[model samples]
Target: MLSVLTLNVQAAALPRARRLLAWLDARDDNLIILTETSNGPGTAYLLEQCRAAGLDVTHTPSPDGDRGCAIVSRLPTTARPDLLAGVTLPGRAVAVTVNTESAITVLGLYVPSSDRAPAKVAKKRAFLTSVIDGLRGLTEGQRAHLIVGGDYNVISRNHRPRYPGFLSFEYEFLDALEQLDLADAHQRLHPTTQAHSWIGRGGNGYRFDYLHTGAALTPHLASCDYLHQPRDRQLSDHAAVAATLRLTVDHRTAVSAPLAEAAALS
Candidate 1:
């Protein structure tokens, strides 16, 4: 069984980072994807713990250093490619291919919220389009086990900005994932349940985090859902999403330096 967890750790909150490491140490999740890491000493310490726990780690730092994404795996991981084809805000996304009993391409993303100026909105749209195009290209040629999960900053529906989320374009961009045959694992397993990962002011909630898997991986999906304990406990504002799959391969492969810098941390 391969367990994968994705979370936005909320800007390197030290206490939460420690708690996250401790929780991860207790589990056997093969892959963990984190966003909004903030490139701080706390995250560095957590990386140390992941290394001690025998997990390979790779990270993409945002230019400003306030946010970033990381991929940690117990199995070997090689850098895949950034989903963006053009210029994009750094540290918001990272991709890696994990080779174990089976090879799975995983992407951790933190899509920008479009509640900003026109330029920022354009950038966000472009980033979303680039990711879609990248996945489309992957599916058109070599089909690999693919899973992309993280804070999308968009909801499942296209309702007006009633609370806090994108309205139209973002919703359509997300719908493209489904068009490409990627199933929203959480929704697939828990159809009709209005589970929210992020709570807003006045007790409103939004399901901004998600895990979308390729069609080929659907059958192997043992489970996919949110872990709200940390969020409820105030360890982090976003709930961690977890997915489990049964794979049957076991080997390592080399990856490009740009995809992965350091060797698996021991």
Candidate 2:
């Protein structure tokens, strides 16, 4: 089984970094994706600490030097340069192919937050549309597994926002994701479960962070859950989400030592 974790480490402050490092050191996940990082000295130091903790990490700093995304894996990972594009607003997205039981392309994303301004709304919609198109292109000639997780900042019919968080265009774009065969990992596991990953204004809770895996990998999915302890303890505003998958050995061509161990552990 391969365990993947996703979290938004809020601006990557020093205190948050300390908490994150300690927490990460205690867990033995195969891969971890982080969002909302900055290019500031604090975030850089945190990334260094992650590497020192024995993780192979890759990061993309935002254009303005904040709100970036990162991917860290115990298994060897190669950044997919083709996945880098202008889809993301100012902050960039990062995608890496993990050499594990199977070659799984894991994407770390931080979608643009909703705003009152029309320009900002348009930007968000365009980014979401581009993301769907890119995913379609990436999986065209490949049989590799796909895992996308991060802060989507959108809502579905069953999941209502505190206020007017997600617009019609945003919802439509998410609906388009189904055409790419992506399924919400948590919802697939527990269709009736209601959970929140982040708290918005007036204490309105929302599940902005999610792990969406390719439908082809559904049979291999073991579990997907949210670890809210960090947010509850004020470690970060967003809770950490984790997904476990049992990959078939036949699909794997390149297996790293760490990934092999992870499979053995499962």
- TM for every model, in the order presented, reads 0.86, 0.87
Estimate, for each residue in 34-98, the C-alpha lDDT of model 1 and write its tens digit: 87777787787777666655568888666676466788887788886544444365467788887
Q: Show model 2 residue runs off by greater than 4 Å.
A: 86-90, 140-144, 248-266
Backbone clashes for every candidate come to 2, 0
lDDT of each: 0.73, 0.75
Q: List the residue pairs that clash in candidate 1.
A: 101-249, 101-250
Candidate closest to the true structure, highest lDDT: 2
lDDT score at residue 68, model 1, on the 0-100 scale: 69
The TM-score leader among the candidates is 2
lDDT of 2 by residue, 1-266 (tens): 78889988888677667767667656667788888888876577667765655568898776675477889887778988677664655355788888865578888888878675888887777888777767867754342378888888776666754446456776675576666778888988999887799887688888888888876676789999999877887878999999899864332432233322332233
C-alpha positional error of residue 72 in candidate 2 after TM-score superposition, expressed in Å: 0.6
